[model samples]
Target: MATPPDWDRNATWGGSNGGAGGSRTPLRQAFSSLSKSSGKKTAQSLSASGSTTPAHPASRSQSPAPEQGDGKPTVASDAGLADDLDNKAKLSLSRQSSVSNKSGAGSAAGRDAGAATAPKGDGEEDTPLQRALKNPYHRPLPGHPGNLTTSQAEALLELTQLLLKDGALHDPEKEPPSYQETQLLRFLRARSFNVEAARTMYLKSEAWKKEFELDRLCEEFIFEEEEAVAACGWRMYFHKVDKLGRPIFIQDLSNLDTTKLLQTTTPERIIKKFAVTLELAVRHRYEACTLSSGRWVDDNMMVVNVEGLGLSTFWTMKDQLQQLLGVLDQNFPELSGRVQIIGAPFMFSAIWSLLKGWLPAATVEKVDIAGSGYLPLILKYVRKEDWPKHLGGECCCSGATATGSDGATPAKGKSDGCLHSDEGPWDKDLVVGASPRPS
Candidate 1:
């Protein structure tokens, strides 16, 4: 066969051959050569002057490219390429070192830049213990409830000791009089001497002395005045009542308009009622039960049967009654029930006033003789003649005599006796006409 133009005559088949027509190399060798030549041509075309461009020094040192033949490129062994990369790296490092040494300022600038970009410290100046102490809401220590340090505890103890000393040394005599006591004394001093202009006599007296006498007399006559005043004060407030003829609401002096009620015609009447009620309560302990059983069994069942309703007891009852009135007003206004009572002076006066103004005459008349102990004393003073009629005279059988079966008159002498005379029609004056005719 004729030899191809591209074929080499002296090419080695599997070894070196003399310049003569020889057997061709292996197919793999031929293909490899061809590829190398092709790669070389491509690389030349891509380069500026039809030559291969040099790679970056670091990259070239790390990995070298394969060699190229006239017609193709050859693949380099991995080991050989690695060695070349190592040599190129050394050269680059040497260059960098030389540059850094020549300009120390450049290296310093780089370091500064790195530092600027790095994270800063948090700038916390307090230590762990200081931070804990400065915390506003720190918890107590393990053994201490208040967590007070020794210095703080000592300071508190000193303050407590000072307070104790002050308290222990405090005395009323050393201090100035209180504002209230001063005012009271001033008022008493001012009212000490009053011109009575009674008949034709003018009297000068200390106000406190007169007040003391008046207060003592009031206690003696009114009986429970002190207790009542202490418990209920001078003024009162009434809240409500039910239809059962019982006080459903009551208050005392503090709640009422003392200036208006005490000065007006109200107080005297209330006092009378209080006195009468107190007397009746004292006298009719067993009688109350009898009356309660006879005519008022059903109604009187709820009535308090204590021996006496003292000022304190009355005040408490009044308060409860007032509360009851309030409840009635809220829950049952249709009953149109009301709370009424005599506070300091007389309960009967309050009842009479209310009856005269708010109720019918018949109701007032009926109320006069209701015989509720508190009312009768006030009725005697207000409507003496009407009192007997309404109250069915003194006795249920014989209505003539002012004396009871025990010969106890109503009010002939002192407070213990009746106020009326005990002389009856049978007890006539001694007749002297027959004696004068015999002489």
Candidate 2:
């Protein structure tokens, strides 16, 4: 893929004077203009009015899946606000583009043609996650013990009420709420079900999303250096699943060439890629996993291999990694299933001591650092047929391998095996289309 033209430009959050001061971001300005142009009060306005009236419509229609062209989700007329945002966002992106052009950067970040929203198609046999896409505030999947408790359900209702009254959930000109019940639960769980604290966190997250232009980033941002970055040994891809059926994200950072990676893609581009990837996982991968598992699968399991990370390499990549981790902690709370760190070298201890201090206590608790003979622990979560033979599991992407109990084998691929083969429940039995699904 050709490189985008806005990768090197600096991304500013809020306004110049800082914290919603000075000049507003182009999207924020667009939203302000939109609110003025439209005579009706926006959700934001309604919330501030402090009216007891409810904001949501009495009933909502489920939208259809992606139509033929461009693989983007189509919204109804009532959802025109999001469509307008997409147009304005595209126009405002040129300021960043011009900055990159002036700097003469060879590879820059550029958005895809349109800002796509989640598909809202209704299929009678759809999985819980798919149904959730169709209806933003979907109820929990039936018969799952992990389903919300009676009190938690009531709390969810209360939380949504608070968000509606505060107008903190929906930013009409930016993006709509997604899996709203599950999303609210995420914040509630993160804040230990304190409605006020969760509300605060949710509001801050929404503000940050606007400042970061998250909707546009998720819909249109393209990682032009994906192949080159992978070639440089910065590999992180969704592979198979763990015991609980969450997608397994294999991040092999042992061979990362920091200098080459920087040369290939800007740090800004890398951050955008990370955000986009998470958005995709939330929108598509998790949904597919939920379908395949016959239960709701909301998060993912990650395995990080850091054998070759020395002090020098750590210093070189620390800032980027820190930013990525911060993004995970602040924006995507309660979404990680587990993080297993394998192939830890002796020096990894010293590195962990420094790094753990910077991470949230909750996030730190989710991570498990394993030493030699860690394969057994990994296998306990990942099936033998799903993991790569090279990684000490049974499956080999090559067709000749006999791995599964049945005559099943992973779809054939290169000799490197499961690391590159994105074979999982997500791909087993689905027919979305030739084009990739919208985030």
After superposition on all C-alphas, the RMSD of every candidate to the true structure, in Å, is: 56.0, 18.2
Q: For each candidate, what is the lDDT?
A: 0.24, 0.52
How does candidate 2 fare on TM-score?
0.59
**Cα lDDT for residue 90, model 1?**
53
Q: Write the per-residue lDDT of candidate 2 for residues 20-135, one digit (tens) a residue.
A: 44432332222222223322332222222211112223114422122323211122121232233234444434533442344342222111100011111122121122222222
Count of clashing residue pairs in every prediction: 36, 2
Candidate 1 has an lDDT of: 0.24
Per TM-score, the best of the predicted structures is 2
What shift in Å separates residue 110 of candidate 1 from its native position after superposition? 99
Model 2 ranges off by over 4 Å:
1-151, 170-178, 398-417, 427-439
lDDT, residue 92, model 1: 38
Cα deviation of 178, candidate 1, in Å:
53
